[model samples]
Target: MGVLLTSCSAPSPTPAPRPKVAVTTQIKQLLPATVSNKTAWSEDIYQAFTHQKLETSVSNLCSVIAIAGQESNFNADAPVAGLPHIAWQEIDRRAAALHIPAFVVRTALSVTSPTGKSYAERLDHVRSERELSDIYDDLINTVPLGQQLLGRFNPIHTGGPMQVSIAFAEQHAENYPYKKGNSIRKEVLSQRGGVYFGALHLLGYPANYTVPLYRFADYNAGWYASRNAAFQAAVAYLSGVPLVLDGDLINYQDDKPSQTELAIRSIGFTLQLSQQNIHQQLMLGQSIAFEQSPLWKQVFAAADKKRGQRWPHERLPGITLQSPKISRNLTTAWFAQRVNQRYQNCLLQSRRE
Candidate 1:
């Protein structure tokens, strides 16, 4: 009776507190030593990574810096040489495509704009992409003919310090933390928003690449381009049908199978899969799941059997960078290699620091 006050259970163990992550400090430390305006760049990058809830590891930080440096050289409002001429060419091309008279297009642009200059004058004097993008936005929103001619598409495909796709940003703008007054195009031109979306584009997805170089290639091409290119190589090797390793699974616009898909289908009988099964697997080219599909396994198996050794599962996609902005011949491999060089340099700088 004297010992009846014994406790039934011991107290629960206290959980350890997580160490506080100093995001801004980490970013500042990881940034390249040669960067001009390091403070401003670091602040914007920190805000972007934090707001987007992205990992702020040195590799991740350096990847962002590498792309930003290559794309815009840390200039948020980077000037595009001959932007005025580019704008005019686009307007003219669009007008011709829409069958709108040249005079009508000219007259529409001659109207006084919000900035007290004629839209024509603004187009003539567009020193940077941001200026041209603003002009296109105004034309699409205000001018009736503009809407018909441009079809709500602004030709400023890439913007901001990272040159992220405006379309990609718009698609993923649901959790965008900033107040939503401006369109995604406008946001892509801002330092913070551009970095946010660009980082998301560059680091948001899952991949099985052993090196950051493939991810950089995917950034320039499309997601999973490296993997899909490898798949294409396997298909080509097994089927004896040469195919461009562009990573396009399907002809998105039509139900017709892409050349790569068709090549895979040609070997369907050998793989013991139907055309439907092959198509289904190839359709997953955009995602990581494609690697798990039967077609993926069979193609590699066949290729390996033929070669008497296992072929590497990833390769630099053989895609030419064919943007109006790019005057020189460039490939996805070239882009990835260039960015990887920068990334390596950044890594070295971080280690030195």
Candidate 2:
């Protein structure tokens, strides 16, 4: 027998179990003293993960928890103070743009809620995003003219103690984890469990994204920016057109033709799509239906090849995160990087376990 040249392969070492991390305690200690809402924080964090039906590893949850802890510090009722002034200015600007009289806009506010309280009173005193959002919801529901005047009425709220996503909470409420709570509103300011759950909602959902930047963007913008950005970038690249990577899929300007539509027009013939067909396809974006369209497959495949590395299927960073409360640019990029750092650290800790 030739000296048994069938050499024995060395046994592969089994990977180690991830370490048991005590993240919740560290997260708790880092929260602001002003935050009396520990239950709300935990509930929100739990709700964030559970609502998405996200089956996260404990380490992953910790990573997300770290970001939430840093972002809101467990304050569900947090409000950005100068928002009232900024909101008034925006209202004026919008009124002038649409030729809607200032008085009419103000008049719309005079309409009452189910409680018969004038919206003007609510608007004047509105401090938190949630509070303002409730007012808008009531406006659309109760006031007959509300839809015509303030129909596009999601006020952008990006500051204060805790940076909550009003849009996120509104759409994904059923997934919230606090079964014991009477309502989502009451749950938001409850305690650690509630806040933790809410925090997870703001951070844990998954996407086919390559980086956390778009998640930050999605947290700031919406869920599908990553996919839309890839399409936008492909169209821009192929048509030799320059476009912002901000992932604004539609043109909001009053002009009948949108720039995005025009860009699609330039490529329409190449793809053998009629202008009308392209316009119809745009609506699919509001649903996940666009992902099934052949255009998406073709463009995404070509774009991936051209970029060597995978392209991020999300919005580029929007506004830098700045606040009168905090010094420095504190941009979304900075926030994502910090969360990612914690994520990596958590991973390392997991490996050690």
Candidate 3:
């Protein structure tokens, strides 16, 4: 009789979550030393990472820090240059668009806001986005025609450290770890809420980007805008149908076919997909599944064959950013490059420290 020895090995235990203090310390170091309230920024960002179960890699952490630096320089109540004038301009524009007389609008704004000053007075003194958002809230709730004038939505679409979109914050508020404080809009003005939501917006979704630059572009544009822009480029090259590589697959607002959709329909017949089928697949453009779609595979394969080279998987979306906050001409490429420069600088800082 021969005795046989058998060895049983247990699966390795899952790696423990990184210590909170260690994670927060790394984030604090990456932040610019000149940034006031460094520890607060670190702690808030740490909460965002943990709550979302987002990876705390140096790159991911730096992406959040860099956007904060660019948008607010770490100030939770960041002062927008000439915000008062901008607010007044928007008020007038809204008033005109809503067919409300200027005097009527002024009379409504004359009512005292929650802040001891008239809404008009507060608008004149508005410096930070937080103040502006508050004024809007007071105006909408208290003043007559406030909601109608503002189209039942706050005029200040973005706010806080990273200037995340309020709509985005509101829509994604279900996973928010902290108390939302009256509304998600109010929370978006806080450091913790802002970073959490901004990080969610920036890195929350999965993108098949080869580098962080495309992700940065997606931050400025919409998600998959970079990838879709590449698709648009390939379609244009193959079909000779001039197209704007703005990364929009189909116009969501219109029932009629968008230029991208029309172009796809023109070639989709050859790719053995009908317009209806094409649309069903293009809707997946918002998800990772878009990459596996018949449109994606056939279009890229055709384009790659026609050009004798593989088309880009992703590219910077050609979108010129138009916002009240912007004074100079800026494009999505500029935004991506600027943030990526900060990303590289932060990487250097991490190495040096």
RMSD per prediction, one decimal? Answer: 9.0, 9.8, 7.1
Off by over 4 Å in 3: 1-16
Judge candidate 1 at residue 61 and give its lDDT: 81
C-alpha lDDT of residue 9 in model 3: 40
| TM-score of candidate 1 versus the correct structure, residues matched by position | 0.91
Model 1: lDDT of residue 254? 90
Highest TM-score: give the candidate number: 3
Q: Which stretches of candidate 2 lie over 4 Å from their true place?
A: 1-44, 47-52, 77-162, 174-206, 252-257, 286-289, 302-335, 345-353
Which residues of candidate 1, in runs, are more than 4 Å off? 1-21
How many pairs of residues collide in model 2? 43
Please state the error at residue 38 of candidate 2 in Å.
7.0
The lDDT of model 1 is 0.81
User: Sorted by lDDT, highest first, which candidate order results?
Assistant: 3, 1, 2
Comparison by lDDT, 1 against 2, better one:
1
| TM-score against native, each model | 0.91, 0.58, 0.93
C-alpha displacement of 262 in model 2, angstroms? 1.6
lDDT of 3 by residue, 1-353 (tens): 11011112432332445899998888888998899888889999989888887777787888888888887888999888999999999989988987889999888888877878899888888899998888888878877778878766788888899889988899899989998769999899999999999898888886766678888888888888999999999988877899999998988997888898888888887789998989999888888799888889999999889989998888899889998888999999999999889889999999998
> Pick by lDDT: which candidate is best?
3
Residue 241 in candidate 1, Cα distance off native in Å:
0.6
